[model samples]
Target: MTTTVIAGKYVLGMREGRQALLQDHYVYVDGTRIEAVTRDAPAAGQAVIRYEQGLVMPGFVNLHAHCLRGGLFRGIPDDLEMDPWVPKLVYHILLPLTGIAAKELTPGELHAVTALGMIDLLRGGTTTLVDMWHHGQEMFFDVAKEVGLRTVGAPFIMSASNSRLGEDGNPVWDYGNDGLAQLAKSVALFKARDEGHAGLAQVAIGPHATDTCLPELLRECRRAADDLGCLLTTHFAQTPQELALLRSRYGMSASEYARDTGLLGRNVILAHAGCSTDEDLKVLADTGTHVANCAFGFAREGQNFPYARFARAGVSTGIGTDSHGMDLIGELRVTGLLSKQFFHQAHTGTAHELMRAAT
Candidate 1:
């Protein structure tokens, strides 16, 4: 394998079990694997990419994302003040409209759109991205392989709620989808496309959300993920309405609902626990489930998902750009600022902590 040496003015590396920012460092790569990060000079004649004034660090792993959706609705500012008590846009604006766009565009056209999202991800310094999309959209994987970007494609498994905004402007849905059938399709896509990239690609079981999926569906997805030895992800506590709906239907918060549904575990990534209660955080921490905080998306709607809230709860927290933007680096600033404000402490979200969350 070819050895490429990247010399950066500033680099993030490990030291004494903590993140350390190293200066004038050389990062050596042997093809796909990182060989080392040091100031040592590489062997003579090695291909060296020297950055005189640059920050070189680990490529980010975005824990939750919707690349195509983010790209399609890139700069539309959602300035409408959101009622914190409502499950605002996923049903009314985001999902239904994206579904229409996905169905209307030709497969090739959709692939181009997907490519556009990936390009944004690459430009934003994301090496690995965990993205969930509607079922049967296997071409998303095709784009990942073509670009050589590490990817976790979570094809959605939803029990059809036939979600829509009611005449009175409230979100409406019912338990009507066959999630197992969709799981089969995701598995098939995994088998067909997730190999041959030296494990750079994977397929995670993505249940859309608690409101859109039945509890039985979530339970079965956990079982399938276990049997297949893959990752599983879903939206949890995205809005106050979802929490109220779950409480009314299941007598539990989304975190409690996850525990009951067998969806809380290390291999699981639950997105947007922004609306979670203190008790919910306790449940999440106790279960060792990781939370993917996509704060920028909620921030646009006047909601802030403070990273400190989850991190302080002892929940393993990571950063994701979600549908607002694919720039993980930019999202870090927003996440840190929100975290500080949420905790009312300037030291709550240190630079190291924020960078650690991104990686």
Candidate 2:
């Protein structure tokens, strides 16, 4: 195999159980794999590309995102809390638009929008993105392949509720066949793309949210994920309205319902546990469920996630943009600052800890 040496002024990586910044380091790449990274010069006959002034580090892994509709719904729903926001902006406005756009947009248009999001992700140094969206899984896989980024696409599956505003301006529930066909289609899509994509792409089951899916559906999704040996992700306790809905409907907290329904596990990655309680956090910790903390999106609505609490509770936490922005560096900075401010202790969220979450 052909080998190449990339020499940079500074290399930022791990060494001896700590973060290290090495000066004048050379990284050796043999075809697709990294052979070595060291301060010594490459062999005499090896091809070398030198960067006089740059920092090289591992790429960011965005644990939660929605690429297809991320750029499309910007600026329309601003400065609103979850109560009015969900009914008016999300259910009434964005949901219908998403369905229409998914069907009506031509292939080129779909590719263009998806490519724009992926480019923004790459420009912000994100090498891997886990995205959940409605419709167009194949198109998203195609875009990820074209952009040469590792991606996990989870096609959205909704059962009891479709997130539509009723005549009374409240969120409505459909409660039909529990979206079993959609789940099956998603599993089939996972096998089709994940098995054929040469490891560049993967698939996960997305059940939308706790308030949207039925109990039976959630249980079946967990079983399917275990059977397929893939990840299962959902939005958990994202908003106060969601918490209220869960309490009223199921007489249980979001995390309680999830745990009882067999949804909490190591393979499950939950997004936006901002409204989760201490009990919910305990459930997450005990079950080894991973939390994807996206600070910017929730902060816009005048809220903050319990990231520091999650860290302290021994819950595996990672940073994400949540489709609000693609800049992982900015998200990392915001996560550190917001977490510190929320806890009123600067040492609670150190730069190193935040960097660890991002990576």
Candidate 3:
């Protein structure tokens, strides 16, 4: 087998544990692994693809996302008005609508939507992403394989996956929201699809959100992730309602609940953290829990996801596109500008650090 050499004008290579932009570099690829990144030419017979104006770099990793939903609501909710009862855009609009789509759309319709979403990810240069959706994750798996994007399918295990709007315009959740049961289904999906796949797809333990899941269920999710040796991810500190709920029920913040349940760790990737307090940031920093910051979606809902705060707090931070606008480049560019503006610091969310977080 001959090696495929990507010789480019500029390559964003690595040096001394930091990003180094190397000019006139040749990156040798032996199958999937990058064999070398150097200025010297490869010895003898090899396939060479030279690009005089190309800038080669590692593909972006969207740390938290809902690809299908992003496709579904792409152009619809840009200027949506928020109802009084439905204060949270994601809970009231995104997830509920996506769930409805899952039940209403035919399998073929679902396939097309999922494929479009995955294709969008590829077009955006996202070679890998963590897709978190509630139902019909098998459609997600199939689309990931077909499109060839490395996916970590995190089936959302909500303690109350089912809910309905009451007459008073409040969510009336059924009591059948079993977190352990939902988790088992996710694990089964892991064993079935992600077990022997050729590294293109894997699974993660996702317990929806702290407010949506009970304490016992969150604890079980940690154990399940540990037992399976997979990553654990969930929504954290996204809304004021969520924070209030956690504080009311457990008398602890979302970060503290996560820490108490043993879910706060290096293997954990918590999405959002928009409403996190200083103590919560401290918990995130001390536990080494990674934060998947998706500021684009938050901006659409008239909220700023202070990524600079998380970065300054020494929390491990990564980027995600979240529900709509799956363009990760736009995610970084827009989020960086928003961060600098919101935090009143030009140095906040620098291009170098933002690119690093995305990767």
Error of 2 at 283 (Å): 2.0
Candidate 2, residue 43: how far the Cα is off, in Å: 0.5
lDDT of 3: 0.83
Give me the overall lDDT of model 2: 0.80
Q: List the residue pairs that clash in candidate 3.
A: 159-177
Compared with the true structure, what per-residue lDDT tens digits does model 3 show for residues 1-359? 56789988999989898999999999988887899999998778766898889888999999999888877888777888884325446656666788889889898988898888888889888999898987455878877888888999899887777754456443445678766778889888888877433588888999877766777888899999999888999988887766776787779877778888877999899999888898899989998999999998878778888678799899999999888877898899988998899888899899999988888
Q: Model 2, range 1-359, lDDT digits (tens) per residue?
A: 98888888898777888988889898888876888888878778777888789877778899998876677766655665456335355566666777877889898988888888888999998999999887554789888988988998888888842567567454666546546888998888877888533488899999987767778888888888888888999888876777787788789888779887777989999998877888888889998999999988777766677468789988899988885767788888888888888889989878878777777
Instruction: Indicate the worst ten consecutive residues by lDDT in candidate 3.
Output: 164-173
TM-score of each: 0.93, 0.92, 0.93
Alpha carbon lDDT of residue 52, candidate 2?
88
Name the regions of candidate 3 deviating beyond 4 angstroms: 83-86, 164-172, 195-198
